[model samples]
Target: MLVRINPASCPSDGHLAALTGERAFCSEFKYRRGMEIFGEGEDAEYVYQITSGAVRTCKMLPDGRRHINSFHLPGDMFGFENGATHRFNAEAIIETTVRITRRRNVLDAMTSREKGAMNLIGFVTQNLQHAENRMLLLGRKTSLEKVAAFLLEMDQRQDHPDMMILPMNRRDIGDYLGLTLETVSRALSILRDQNLLRLGGATQRRVELLDRDELARLDA
Candidate 1:
């Protein structure tokens, strides 16, 4: 099921262009849920910034296991790469809209090579930081800790402070957090039982953090 995202105020075209950082070079595109935005090993010709929906960056192993690297919400950027081809696959987790700019167009539109390079470095560093955090979560965190950290991370990303309408399923979460499906479900149930979080809505994708401090402790 798709989770509805309600932005406080929608931005105009001008604002969107500014947000994309490519101005006139940017074009809008929409993708249906489960659509492949870009595939692994494809040419990294364009960079994308989410306009309103969620997306996921993933990798498929030789044995056919899927590993989700990151979940991108509105305003998050993806597809920026230093290499000629994308290292991982990118897919729309929900109905999505994005402002996309071709690599050559972005370079041509830049005022200076220095500024463009700086911008690229910034994006790379941001991505690196997230990757580092996720590495820690997977390498050292216990199942409960992993799930707690995932919730806190998603809580911060979602529009609401205490509530989150998760765009992905438990299986998706498990893949991202390096946990099994049963372990993910069990962790969530444990959190709910401890009164640290509450599952709401008919679909139960709506999660409300009832005790953030306690949850933080668990994550810690």
Candidate 2:
């Protein structure tokens, strides 16, 4: 579940290495399924990269209801913010490994290198685009459309074209799509009834899309 690394994967050319020293590359950790990586309002000490598995960033309402914002899979970076504390909590949806770099070290690297600043800007910009898309999904899309969009997005992340493995559950899906769990379940059932998808098991990890065209149309 939890792992620590003294030296981590870095750019081979030693460019980033020269800027951040070997010590900066330390502190990689692995989290168990449903493990909390960081808590809301916790000090923003480091930024993380998903080395394996998946993570979900979410927030809780005053009444203790959770709303999942997004899911991050391998190669995705998260927990990077220009603030003293994290705005949301990050938890592993499944077993996950993440590489971390101290916030101060990252800032120092950016300060010394224009390219570093640019790269950080680009990362933030991409995240902003994703957030904007989610906002649109939440504000305008119907329940069916939202589920369709979620499926398509998950499909893109999958390795096999014919199958997709969802890491999170229906409740998490509902929260992310701005629907209730019953609504999410109903939409998925409709998709199945229409022969658009075949669910593999109760976990809903394996799904085969039988009608991508129809699914795409639902999003329109």
Candidate 3:
């Protein structure tokens, strides 16, 4: 889906203009659930910001096995790899809207201001930290611990005080956690059995935490 920024809420008029360029060139393109945003090895000409919904980035092995690298939610940015082409495929997990900006414009803006460069560096560093954490999660954490860690991270990111709404499904979670779909479902069942989480409705959108401290301990 096409997304446009309201001029009033933008960080800076000049920056916004530079980012969007001449007219509001914004267009909304809708993607059905599981639609590909961009494929692996495609030219990375544009950087994307999630306007609504969620997107999953994944790499696939020659044998057709998939490993999800991360999920990008509203306001999250992706497709900013420095190389000419993207290394992974990005797909929308639900109906989604994304604001697109040409990479050349962003690079030019960074060249004009040291602050822009700093911001880009900070963004890259944050992504690196998340990658390291995921590496730890997949390489060492137990199945239960991985699920617990995932919930805790989602809670922190979404800042849901009473209940957390998951935007992705079991298969997406499984690919991310390096487990099968059945494993992810079983892990959620185990958490529910332990009274650590309450699943609401058939969609599994509502998730209430019963014990924050216990969840943290499991993360540890």
TM-score of each: 0.85, 0.86, 0.86
State candidate 1's TM-score: 0.85
Candidate RMSDs in Å, in order, are 4.9, 3.5, 4.0
Clashing pairs in 1: none
lDDT-best of 2 and 3: 2
Q: Which stretches of candidate 2 lie over 4 Å from their true place?
A: 5-24, 111-114
Positional deviation of 214 in candidate 3, in angstroms? 0.9
By lDDT rank, best first, the candidates go 2, 3, 1
Per-prediction backbone clash count: 0, 0, 4
Residue 50, model 2, lDDT: 78
Q: In candidate 1, where is summed lDDT lowest over 10 consecutive residues?
A: 7-16
State which candidate has the highest lDDT.
Answer: 2
Task: Please give, for residues 1-220, the per-residue lDDT of candidate 1 as tens digits.
Answer: 3333432333324323333343445567778899888999999998777887899999988888899988988877778777999999999988998767677765564545446566655666777888899888999999999999999888877754757889898999999988889999999999999988899887678998998888889888
Model 2 agreement with the true structure over 1-220: per-residue lDDT tens digits: 5767546655311223333444345456889999999999999988777777899999998987888888998867678777889999999999988777777776786677757766666767777898888888899999999999999888876754777878888999998887899999999999999999999977876889998889889987
| Local error of candidate 2 at residue 191 (angstroms) | 0.8
Which tens-of-lDDT digit does each residue in 30-58 have in candidate 3? 57688898999999998777767889999
Locate the minimum summed-lDDT window of 10 residues in model 2: 11-20
